[model samples]
Target chain A: MAYELYYWDGIQGRGEFVRLALEEAGAEYIDVARQSGHAMGTGAMLELMKSKHEPHIPFAPPFLKDGDLIVSHVANILFYLGPKLGLAPPDEKLRYVANGLQLTITDLVAEVHDTHHPIATSLYYADQKDEAKARSAAFIKERIPKFLGYFEQVLQQNPGGPTHIVGDKLSHVDLSLFQVIEGLRYAFPKAMKTYMSNYPGLTALRDTVGKRPNIAAYLRSDRRLAFNEDGIFRHYPELDLAP
Target chain B: MAYELYYWDGIQGRGEFVRLALEEAGAEYIDVARQSGHAMGTGAMLELMKSKHEPHIPFAPPFLKDGDLIVSHVANILFYLGPKLGLAPPDEKLRYVANGLQLTITDLVAEVHDTHHPIATSLYYADQKDEAKARSAAFIKERIPKFLGYFEQVLQQNPGGPTHIVGDKLSHVDLSLFQVIEGLRYAFPKAMKTYMSNYPGLTALRDTVGKRPNIAAYLRSDRRLAFNEDGIFRHYPELDLAP
Candidate 1:
């Protein structure tokens, strides 16, 4: 049976991380919320989240359903999928490292979300724009460099080439790093461009992951949604810095 | 071999979740950062966090080093420890539910952290006091009810007694729930008092978890640190609500 992915019908949001993995592995899966019929809409998604029956409900979208296993939390979901999809290393230590890197991606994603919604997730972006401006400024200045620098160092230290985050082969961490770079470029074009040159290895890894046959095919496919204001990584000119 | 828990020396910050589990399970472990001469200090912790050696470095503390395996993130660490410590259910489905509950706790913890540092983690509480006031007001008014209500439902829905979050047996979620209750009482005493009586089942669970022989012993032991201003759950009168 195909794995079932339940998330908002539209926009990438957190689900894109799952999408990238499923797409890269060319796995059979259904984006349940996106279906026109026999599936729940965004309203249903919200209701399920608020439902009292499923006390073990997800706090947010991007939960995956594989047979009976219902998993949410981006990193947690990926931890289950990595080995199943052949995107993770076989060795236990390497798997732990891959998972550790994915959790770091989770931190980066949270930071990205915070840039736009520093005050409250319940509030609108416009309501928090001023705060976002200040938060984004710090994020671009301190957080981006610190996070990317760490990734760069990891690449340099890898006994394998700098192509992968964990080892010689592509793991879930590489795909996530690629996504982070993509999201940053989309969200903060100017700032990313200004700092992009500093992390050449990261840039290269991003390019390589993008050019992977499965990923490249998936990107060209209609299943890949465009980044929009509704998504986690939105492109706002004011939030971007000039290179 | 004892699990080596690496966190900041002083505060019962995020690491407390892990510590509570180890304590309740009567597991052997070393609070590495708390050890003198043998472990890294705050500066070393910061440097290690920024070190380029591991691309998968944790974004923050509460990382666990068990033998060669290093795990971070509160929920992730618990996910690893839950089963190892015999605090998780044997069945996979039950394990998923426990993890789901743990992830929810993570969300609550993040929201609590944001109550004081709404604008940015880099900014001081004084810098964001106004925003925090607004944010904390919302947290008290909306977020608390939503989270608490969900936990209440979990207790009500449990085929087992309302004493556990997952099943009849004690799990890491129960321990974490106890910590959540304790933290909320410490951080928002007045606000919590008004709602405390409403969730009797949850309160019962908290009280029961606290009364567990291992937990009771741990709490009385010097190993259990007192909650203070340095931790994630801080008590600021202006930020808290009245009963």
Candidate 2:
């Protein structure tokens, strides 16, 4: 049966991480909320989240339904889907390592979101622009490098080589890392200019993931959502910085 | 062999989540960095984090070494340690549900840290006081209530009754929730003034976990680190709210 993926309709946000993996594996799935004339539309997605009737409760969207099983959280969802979709190594040790890497990516994603919504998620960007400016400055100068640098080191030390994040083949983490690079680049082009030069290993992985046939096809399709101000990786000129 | 946990020596921080589960289960383990006159001192902790030679790479501390296996990330570490520690259910569905709840707690812990370091982790709280004030206000008024309310709902909906988060047994999630309550209480006593009365199920669960024979002993022992401003949950009186 095709997996049912429930997430917000408009922007990629956290759901994109799950989508990237599903697409890369050529897994049959439906983006429930984004679909039309279906029982699992945007309203249905919110209902599943808020309803206490579910066998499993989801605090938010971007949950997956595989047969009778349900899973949530980007890392948790990927953890479940990684092996099933053949995106993770079979060895237990390497599999957990891939999970750790995905969790780290989750951390980076949260940091990226904070750059724009420093004060409060409920508040508009205009209401918290000053705070965001300061936050974004620190993020662009310190955090981006810290996170990207750490990923570079992880790539450099990869036993399989500096290509995939874990082992020799493509893993969910590689796909997620590619998304991180894409989101970061779109949001902070000026800051990422130096990062591209400083972390050739990460860039190479990103380029490789981008060139994957399935991912390449997905990126070229209209199904791939654009990074926008409403989403996690917003491209405000003030948030971007140059070396 | 006993597990070797490497984290900061002084603060409970994220490591405490792993510590709580181990403590509650009466497991044999060493809080490596916290001990003295050993190979696994604070110095060794830093060395392992910086070293690229280990089988697994940890971007930060709060990593665990079990035999040759190394794991990082609080939720990821807990996922690996849960079943082994007898802190998770045997049933696969409930186990993953517990994991989802733990990952949600991870999200809450990150938010708690952001209250102090909203602008940047590198910047001191004093430097970001204004931003923190705004962030904490939003947190207390909105995020705290939303998260706590969700947990309350989770408890109320439990088929086994509101005694535990996942199944009828005491999982790592309940312990983590107890810690979250403790951390929030310590950091935002004034803000959590109504939390005791409002979230009766949550508060009740916290009381039960606190009274667990092993947990009660651990809390009284020197092994249990005190909640301090140095950690994720910080008590800046200015950040606390009345309602």
Candidate 3:
């Protein structure tokens, strides 16, 4: 049976990470909430999160249901899929490295989310705009450099050139890095442009991952959702850094 | 060779999650930064983090260096250890469930951290105390119930009595829950006292895990570091809710 992915129907949030990997691998999976006429949408997703029978319910959306297994958390889902989809290194050491990189991406994603909602997730963006502004400034100035620099260092140390984040192979981490770069470019265009030139290896890696036939095709396909204000990576002009 | 756990030496912080699992399994590992006269103290740990490596390094601490594999992220490290140390369920589905639960714990931990550091991770608690007071109140009222209720529901659904979070065996998730309970009690004694009685299953699970010989021994040993202000869960009277 095809794997079933359960997440909010609209907006490419954390679920997109899983969707990208599945699309790249040409894995058979159904986007359950997106299916027409299905009761499964954001509501069903939330209900499952509060399910009394599932001892391992997720705290939020972007959960995957593969037969009997229900998995959540972007990195955790990727950890399982990395091996299953051949998107991970075959060696245990390399796999761990890939996972480590993915977790860092998770941190970057959290930072991105914090940019808009610094005070609380439940509070409105308007309620915390000032706090968000301050946090976003620090993120753009400090966090973006620190994170991108770490990725650049990783690429330089690869011994395999500036193509892959791990070794010579294209792993899940490469795809994630591509997504992060794309999201940052969309979300904080000015800030990313200011820092992009400093990280040539990361730029090359992102460009290479984008050019992959499967990824390239997926990007052009109708299945790929557009980024919007509702998504984690939002592009508000007021939040952008000064050029 | 033994595993080398690299994290801040002083507080339990995120590293304790990894430490508890290692100790429970009786795995040979060194708390690298905690060892005296060993160059791998906080300074060395900072240097390693700032190192320009090929595989992107971890953004923060609680990373493990196992031979050539440098694994970071508390949940990610446990994901690796669960299977390797025989603490995870043997079945693939069950393994996914355990991981899902661990990720849920991660969300809870993030909430607990936000109670004190609502503004930004880089900012001091004093700088954000006003916002933290409001944020912590919401967390004590909303997040605590939501997370505890979910965990209690998990235990009630476990099919395997109130003893474990997964199946009949003691998984890494159970250990994490034990830590969560301990941290919550430390951070919000009055608030927890008011609501914890509602989560009997979770309370029982915590009690049972606490009674485990290995965990009990580890808690008494110097190996279990004390919780403090520098850690994720801190007890500030101003942030606490009155019973």
In terms of TM-score, which candidate is strongest? 2
Off by over 4 Å in 1: A50-55, B43-47, B50-57, B159-161
RMSD (Å) per prediction: 2.2, 1.1, 1.9
Q: lDDT per residue, candidate 1, B20-131, as tens digits?
A: 9999888999887777664456666666667666445666787887775668778888877888899998876777678777878887898898889877778888998988
lDDT tens string, model 3, A29-54? Answer: 98878876555566677777777776
TM-score of each: 0.94, 0.98, 0.95
Interface RMSD of each: 2.7, 1.2, 2.3
> In every candidate, how many clashes are there?
0, 0, 2
Docking class of 1: medium
Ranking by DockQ: 2, 3, 1
> Candidate 1 on A39-75: residue-level lDDT in tens?
4566666776677666466767888877756787778
Q: Rank all candidate structures by their TM-score, best first, as comma-separated numbers.
A: 2, 3, 1
Q: Please state the CAPRI-style docking class of candidate 3.
A: medium
Give the TM-score of chain A in candidate 2. Answer: 0.97
* Structure candidate 1, residue pairs in collision: none
- What is the Cα-based lDDT of residue B236 in candidate 3? 96
User: Over the stretch A1-243, how does candidate 2's per-residue lDDT look in tens digits?
Assistant: 999999988899999999999999898999999987757799988887777876567888778988767788999998888889999888888888898989989999999998889989998999998888888888888888888988999899887888888988999999999999999999999888877899999999989999999999999999998888888999999878774
**Model 3 lDDT, residue A91, Cα:** 81
| DockQ, Cα level, model 1 | 0.50
